[model samples]
Target: MRPEDVSALALLLPGVVEAAHQGHPDFRIGGRIFATLWVEEERVVLKLTPGDQEHLLAEAPDLFAPVPGAWGRRGWTNLDLWDADEAVLRDALLAAWRNVAPAALDGD
Candidate 1:
């Protein structure tokens, strides 16, 4: 997947918007960031539960890894766009979006 592909998929989620933060492109729902495009690193970061991060990392170490420091401990995962499978990436994005999305907006 490409950076544009990440942005496009993110926008497909309900109430998601693209915004710039700290020089990176971020995706948010209800004003909370759920994902970020780390352009310089050529990766996409997704906010996930630590367990989810661990599972993904274990399952696809080449495509997924922790973001490092406190953020990583808090479940921030960095995905290599060039290495990630589209289906897996979409699932991760949806999960992150749902995690941060307001209840009503999440339709849950």
Candidate 2:
């Protein structure tokens, strides 16, 4: 999927807002960042739980990878936008959104 596609899909989630972070576009829920777009690099950073990060890394290493260093070990992942499948990206976005969205807005 493309960067715009990723942005569009991310905004479809509940309470999601687009904002700038570190000179990059970021998606937030309940004011907490869940994803960041590194457009120039053709990658998106996702904040996921360590378990989810591990599963995705093992399952789709080509499309998803750790961000590097301590942040990566703490569940920050990098998604290769050009290689990402729309459906898989959508699922990952949802997982990331849910990771930081407040419980009341989680649609439990």
Q: Which candidate has the top score in lDDT? A: 2
Supply the global lDDT for candidate 1. 0.90
Give the candidate number with the greatest TM-score: 2
* Candidate 1: Cα lDDT at 51: 85
Report the error of model 1 at residue 64, Å.
0.7
RMSD of each: 1.0, 0.8
Q: How much lDDT does each candidate structure score?
A: 0.90, 0.93
- Please list all clashing residue pairs in model 2, or write none if there are none: none
Provide the TM-score for each candidate, comma-separated.
0.94, 0.96
